[model samples]
Target: MTARADHLVGVLGGMGPAATADFYARLIQHTPASRDQEHLRVVIWADPTVPDRVSAVLEGTDGPYPAMLAGARRLCELGVTVAAMPCNTAHVFLPRLVADTGLPFVDMIEETVGALTRAGTAPRAVGLLGTRGIVHSRLYQDRLRAAGIRPVEPGPEVQAEVDAAIRAVKRGELATAGDHAVAAVRRLAGGTVDAVVLACTELPVALRDSDRAGLPLLVDPTEQLAVAVVTTCLGAEAHRAG
Candidate 1:
């Protein structure tokens, strides 16, 4: 039987519980549906027990890939139309998940950079904020560069603050996390970047409403990812219905 719209979206999440919730919330907000039935059907496999993604990248261990693969496999078994993972750092293992599941995985980084280009919000340079793994991996750097947008990185001290902010959010210290995040953004913006990307999913939760009175434009990759998820799922659903 074909996968129905009522069971279209498979979420490979739980790199952190809060980020997973935020992604789903954003998906709801982005979807065009106004009622329960109109909304895209979503099934989330939130395995908070998965290994830490940063530790895996930084310390050279298996990390969360195996657990993530298991979740993706289950979703595919259930015949989800497409899958997405909200955690930016978790994307370090996305290729493996896709290979194991043999399913189409939405590329959050690609979607994010594409949003910047298509939105015409950041015509020049863009600033990045995320964990040390995200920066060290250079995940979005080459992609942003190839798109003709310069990627500006925060200095060591400011990056330390970014790292601290990510950790604070993981600890559920949203207030402290917001302060560090705002401070880092202000520093990165001072260097003349046209926009700042909250490349890390946790940042959206941390700085959801923190003041950004005079900083450059802020781009949330999570939001971009959500848009991609909604569009892909809903468009496919419409096609199947027709």
Candidate 2:
């Protein structure tokens, strides 16, 4: 089923709880709110059991497709008008899930790419810092290249570090201010490209503390997607009324 024009946007999240929360916060932050109603009404299903997206991609282990479907279906049953996932790598199975499911999952990478182009990013080299699956997968590459941006990747060692940091967040080791993933950020800093993308939700683990200055970084695809959700699903009437 589709949204009824008044129901809240549903999120199929919590692949890593931290990233899910981040996306939720962004939804609130991006809204032009004066009161509680001004804020978008969001119903979220942050299920961690959806399996490790990075692990399935890199180690060829199990993924959370079935679990993810269950979570999204739950949101639909709850009368969600729209649904999306904050996790990037989990998008790998989006086609399959979306094909059979009634709920439509938003495109995280496409949203980020749209935000970049709207920000007038140079159509040259753009760096990516995501899980091993996203790094190696053509998910970002296919969309980014179509947008005329050559997506750059971290070296093997840096890729390993990023993967480690993502795992660390899942284990609840990193601070909100960002501590454990500094080295990885430094390795893929401004010098690497005009801008960098924290393609994985686990990244911002070392927010300000990481070597994340100088170049612009697309820290949250969820944020960009949320903004679109607010504008589209909710519309200006909601914002104005809020």
Q: All candidates: CA RMSD in angstroms? A: 3.5, 3.3
Q: Which 10 consecutive positions of candidate 2 have the poorest summed lDDT? A: 233-242
lDDT score at residue 51, model 2, on the 0-100 scale = 71
- Residue-level lDDT of model 1, residues 62-116, one tens digit each, is 7677788888888898778878899888777877777777877889998999988
**Number of the top-ranking candidate, with TM-score as the measure:** 1
lDDT of 1: 0.83
Candidate number of the best lDDT: 1
lDDT of each: 0.83, 0.72
Q: What is the TM-score of each candidate against the true structure?
A: 0.91, 0.86
Q: Which residues of candidate 2, in runs, are more than 4 Å off?
A: 1-5, 59-62, 121-123, 190-192, 208-211, 236-242
* Candidate 2 local lDDT, 40-96, one digit each (tens): 567888888777777687776546777988887788788776678888888887777
* Residue pairs clashing, model 1: none
lDDT of 1 at 218: 86
